[model samples]
Target: MKFEVTILGSNSALPTTKRFPTAQVLNVLERFFLIDCGEGTQIQMKRFRLPMSRINHVLISHMHGDHIFGLIGLLSTFALQGRKSDLHIYGHSKLEKLIRFQLELLETKLDYEIFYHTIFGTNIQTLFEDDSLIVQSFPLKHGAMPCAGFLFKEKERLRTLKSDMLSFYNIPIKNRHGIKQGDDFICDDGEVIPNDKLTKDAPKVRSYAFCTDTAYLPKIVPIIAGVDLLYHEATFLKTEEKRAKKTYHSTAEQAGKIAAEAKVKKLLIGHFSARFDDLKEHLEEAKNIFPNTALAEDGKIFSVELDRD
Candidate 1:
């Protein structure tokens, strides 16, 4: 029932003394998902004490070294550790080639099979979905390499049963699930009990969005609107707006603008340029527009509570 993201590395292309490259782990009810494995991602994951073997799905934003350099190391480690579960990776087609090429060069065979899913196009696409969670990949406007942003949405939970009501009606345990799922309960005597009288409202659906290595593309706002938490890359400050535009990156101010326009409950700005010795200015610029902004610091955890605002 837990939903949260752990920031592993928050720096941009370069690894600074204070921060590593871009990486994160999203845990949705113990399903670990690795998002954008950048340099030193393995070390960061170990430092954070996340169970590396539990991460079955990996999402790569783009083939940029800063975004995917650590994938080979992670895969190699999995082999070394004798992993058995089949792994899945989602990204541009080239991502699979890169990993396969490296593995072939090493002449090392892994015990687990890897399934590479091609997620292309400049539109939103479903990557993974289950009864409890759905993960979608949306295009990120970052050059022609075909980067992607991700959206994680938790499905609406069933209603909580009213204990007193259940006992009052002597509802059978076998019928409780249907009652929680909004089905009316029929007594043994053929009396119908409205579902609302036996159960409270279902928990609200929650969501999180991850946008990185992209420009200020407002089109994505619709896809990520009203997300409980949004982690958008802020690679520079407004002072370097032109550079950010040229590199297809976003400034902290621009990140804030997107958050404000999207109406997300909270915003986390990261992917900081190595040139920045301190991130106070970056936080300040983003907060100027979206007051609920926080820096995506390394090892920081951002949780999406079930309650809706």
Candidate 2:
């Protein structure tokens, strides 16, 4: 039961000597979510031994080159590797045309089908879901046409019957499912066994939110409130707050403000400006408000285990 996030790239627009661009890997259950593929994202995946085939879903925050430049390369590699599974991509409406243009220019035909869901509104809507997890997107103010932040939540878990309780009560093996589902078993002799005495409550659901390339907007607080983990772009330190606003990006302090207001459990900030050689200022600025903040670095992996209590 591991739910984790791996940072592949953390640089904002330009690639620095220490960082790449924007890319993150979200591992929920057994599914892989590639969020905002930037340059060299495929290489990072290979370095980390992440299975490209298993990654069928990609969520692009915006159409900026730093966020989506690596998509073409990744798709090309998938084709080269002879992938045959249908892939689904969620992003703004222009993504369909943008990707189609590249494919058309290259005259490349994918062996797999590519499904695109273009997000155009500012509502919190479920983009896709499976038995284990659900993914939703909400609009962010990135000054582009429309950029979105994504949320991934694990599905509700079922209770597991304690083996000791079952063995102590001499419960039949065939009735385990019923017990786990809170159903009491009635014996042939008319004996009743309460469900609470057999099983505990299910594990709490875990959630993660990705907010990038957005200005200091507190309106998104409600949408991502109480998320287990939050990844927000912190392109500048507090000293450069004006610059961040001019660029429609958030300062480290601003990112922390949003996380604190939203009451997120943990905050990871990335997309640092190229001017800063050291990231201590960014971390300190965020920690001043949100003590749980961590500066995002390339190749850094953060694993999140949900608290059952």
Candidate 3:
């Protein structure tokens, strides 16, 4: 299965000529999940060639304009394209009101149903789950705004049957499911065939965490520990630590600290402030603490895999 995260926008607060605000798309086994929809997110998506119709679930970190301003435009475009699948949006209570009011004022109706799941309070909980994957939401410290971060995890996969061994053992086709489920096969002579001889272990489950628009909070470390990939907001540099604290944002160093504390396999830092024209300092600062850190650039894609460490 293909699991990757594509950065659509990676700036913070304001959009510059080269960078847009915050938005990302996570593709797990071809299913796309969008995170944050800042202004110009649609344009970024188009530039990256990510099909809007493939994104069925949209997760919002906060109500800040830099995080959610492009939602209306994206939804409107989906409606214009005659999309009929129900779209699921998970966010705070105000998001529903904001979207519904905008559509009502424009007298525009959507062909698809919009299902809103309001995440209330500040508790870490499972937001969605299915046979293949699961998504969880945890509260983030983003000043007065009730913000959240999402964790996407792949479920345990079924073991694979060794075709050559199965043929050697003369196992019937009806017993394939039992072998995959780790059950021993009983032959006509009542001899037991070991499950390990017929099957191989499945790939390890992979997880990705999205932590943006939050301050340096250590409490989140345990919740996201040992993830395969972590995308944290580095809205400022270490030199602007005081300003970052005041605005409840994280510096590159702070983001690196979180990733190191959580023991994640790789760290992706983004949500850069527009004051700086380059990201050399951000990359250097983060790498000083976490050597596996990388800067999140627009249209960049990161693949999720089992951590060798």
lDDT of 3 by residue, 2-103 (tens): 789999899998889888999999999899999999999889999999988989999998899999999999999999999999999999999999999999
lDDT of each: 0.93, 0.89, 0.93
Q: What would the TM-score be for candidate 3 when compared with the true structure?
A: 0.97
Listed per candidate, the RMSD to the true structure in angstroms reads 1.4, 1.6, 1.5
Q: Write the per-residue lDDT of candidate 2 for residues 75-183, one digit (tens) a residue.
A: 9999999999989999988888999999999998799999999876578878998887989989888775588999998888778787788988888988998788789
The sequence of per-residue lDDT tens digits that candidate 1 reaches over residues 124-171 is 899999999999999888876688999999988899899999999999
Best of the two (2, 3) by TM-score: 3
Ranking by TM-score: 3, 1, 2
Candidate 2 residue spans exceeding 4 A from truth: 170-174
Q: How close is every model to the real structure, measured as TM-score? A: 0.96, 0.95, 0.97
